[model samples]
Target: MKKLFFLSVLLFGIFSFSQTLSSTLNKTTLALGEPAVLKINIENLQGKDVKSAPKNELLPFHLEETKDEIIKKQNNYTREIEFAVFEEGKFQIPALDFKIGENTYKTIPYEIEVINTAKKGDKISDIMNNKEVKLGLKDYWQLYKFYVLGAIALIALFIIIYYFIRYSKREKNTPKVISNKTLKDLELLKKKKYIENGNYRLFYVELLEITRNFISTQYRIPANVLLTDDLIDFMKQNNTISQENEKVVEDIFLRGDLVKFAKTFPDKETMGADFNDIKDFVKRSSKDIEFENIRSDV
Candidate 1:
């Protein structure tokens, strides 16, 4: 009977020593937004691996896992888990369950206190026991009156000086003529060699854009955003473009639509002819515009 009692005690002591878990906090109290470490130490794991800790949402304290490790020493294993918290409260780090072999073990809960430093006017006095300073606008204005007045005077002086300089230079500068801009852009497009490079789609799109932009700028029409058919109808109704130039515009628009949407390829000679037609249309339209302006002036 004595031998039996000794055997049972030995087994109970070994079972108790096989699984051990303890948790501690690096600080019992901390200011809000400051981090404190909660260290969990586990020993004598008995050749069993520890399952991963539960997610942070399950814990009472808002905690995040930092560097944690399970190390083997001789016949026993030790595990150290670190957590950090930033919230302000008196909260408990709940018990953590770890799986070992077929059974589960848990660590003791730890508590921490977090103090908030920010407060409202009355609350600040209550928490910090300090008096508040009250200053009127007149007092503040007296301190920076010269700086404020100087800034306002400088801004007013800058505006007056800028207007004088701008008025003096306005008559010396000539505004950009839209026709000249269109011709320059067209010439640059030709140098890109889109036709010779067999980029028919790009060539047609850019060609259409140049013509539409020219018409839009010179006639105050929204030609750039219009479909080919709608643009032709608009120009016909307005009678803004001469009949001959109108036909040229219609033919170019049709060819561009075919090339862009239908993926039709045109020969280099055909593309060149289209280019020349656009140039002719621009030249005739510009002359007509100049004649109208002269007539209006007279």
Candidate 2:
């Protein structure tokens, strides 16, 4: 009977020692990319409680807080340490040592292995069943002809708008100023009396140069290249002169050339007539002139 009692007490002490320092893992084999839960359970069965688990350095994997559960009857505290290993490999969990009062308890080390997924022929696994997505029938596809037509229309519209703006600006900047001289000035120019002075050639040259200079200053056109015919044609094309004005201009040019190059002397009255034609031309075109205030010498 005494031997039996001793055996019972020894067995109870061994069971209590096993409970004091122990660790366990919840899974035996974990797949790659899956979580494996390792739990280290330590029981403070001694008379005093020390600090919680010792501070650890930067670990290979992540760890979480330790959880505590109390057993009132045993006057014991259990600390549950949880950790996860996310890769596929054999991993060893180090032993955890705890100091209670002057006594120290150490837990046994543990290890685990993670497995990889199986391969199949072009068929996705059951884990990725919901990842296959399909396109709907309502998506839009623009045709090449539609794009080309739109581009050409846009280009044509731009060209038309550009030319319209350019021409409007050209018309606005076009010179409208002709001679702004008074009728009295024209009459005075006619009465210069070149034929009476017997200088018909000088008279024709001065008259032609003055007319060209006036046109040059008024219309901003270079007078050097313009022949009498070209000037008449331009005036007609631009509707600058009436038909009567053009007829008078032609007669003046003919008489001026006869006296200037042909050396045919004109009578004073014929000279006066040509001069009067110039005066009338200036008068008729005066209203068409756009006046600009010329800057004067200070």
Candidate 3:
């Protein structure tokens, strides 16, 4: 097992009959999270095997080992490493240590520049200087949308739930909306595949509407026009749902409102989970499934 060492800080390697190792970087400058390539090649391996590329993880940037290539005829070894820097600054991808069999090897350090700013220049500009840009509705909305939308959503939700509760108490004698119809609504929503298509806003809109409509018909509530808070209040007053189930239903509606008005994004899993939650709620909370079955039989 022979050892190799490089005292030279120069970027290039010295070639020899025994073994020559060299490293090079494909890029030195990149935007934050941009990736750079480091290539290492070894020649005259004399039949000993370096199974894989070695990487230094203690460095400032994230590093990953890419595919390695070995040529038996030429007795050469080559590997390309891909690394990305999230931090903005000049960085040195420190020399990586490699232990192949009993021989140890090191790759020379490489320089890199990671820029955080969106501009083409390297430096981050100073804090925003006040400039009189004409403010438009869009500008104002962008500045305060989270707060304003949140307030509106909260208010709308309250109105909806209040009406739902008021009417729900009056509909105790009303026939339960059939389970099949509610199930069809769920099926229709699934067929729309809004989440799959990345139309989250419309997806939530339809889902909330469906859930609310189901509640409106099932419990004699005007849920079609209500929000999460209204439904919560209605449930609490009516004792229509157990605390655990009420929590699930409330969370579903709240999440729907967030996606609809708060510009919240729900992932596929979240969307699917919420949909299933609504479906389960409708199945369990609907009051007259047995009567519906008997009526259908008749």
> What are the candidates' C-alpha RMSDs?
13.9, 18.3, 26.5
Candidate ranking (TM-score, best to worst): 1, 3, 2
TM-score of each: 0.40, 0.33, 0.37
lDDT tens digits, residue span 1-298, model 2: 9999999999988887654655566776767655544444455454456444543321234332233333322435555444455666787666666666666766666676776775656665486446665645433223355677889999999999999999987765444323544344455555776667867787778777776676665555555478877877776775544567657766776677777777678877777778777876766654444222231222
Q: Which stretches of candidate 3 lie over 4 Å from their true place?
A: 1-177, 286-298
**Which candidate achieves the best lDDT against the true structure?**
1
Report lDDT (Cα) of residue 41, candidate 2. Answer: 47
Model 1 weakest lDDT span, ten residues long: 170-179
Worst 10 residues of 3 by lDDT: 1-10
Q: CA lDDT of 68 in candidate 3?
A: 36
Point out where model 2 deviates above 4 Å.
1-192, 288-298
> How far does residue 238 in candidate 2 sit from its true spot (Å)?
3.1
Sort every candidate by lDDT, greatest first: 1, 3, 2
Poorly placed runs, candidate 1 (over 4 Å): 1-176, 291-298
Q: Write the per-residue lDDT of candidate 3 for residues 1-298, one digit (tens) a residue.
A: 1222344422234443357678888899988877777777877777766644334443443543333333443477777666677777787777776555577888899888888757576686679877987999999999999999999999999999999998887565343434557779889989988878888888888887877777676666677665578778987786655566678878888887888786688899898888888777767764444444556699
Q: For model 2, what is the C-alpha lDDT against the true structure?
A: 0.61
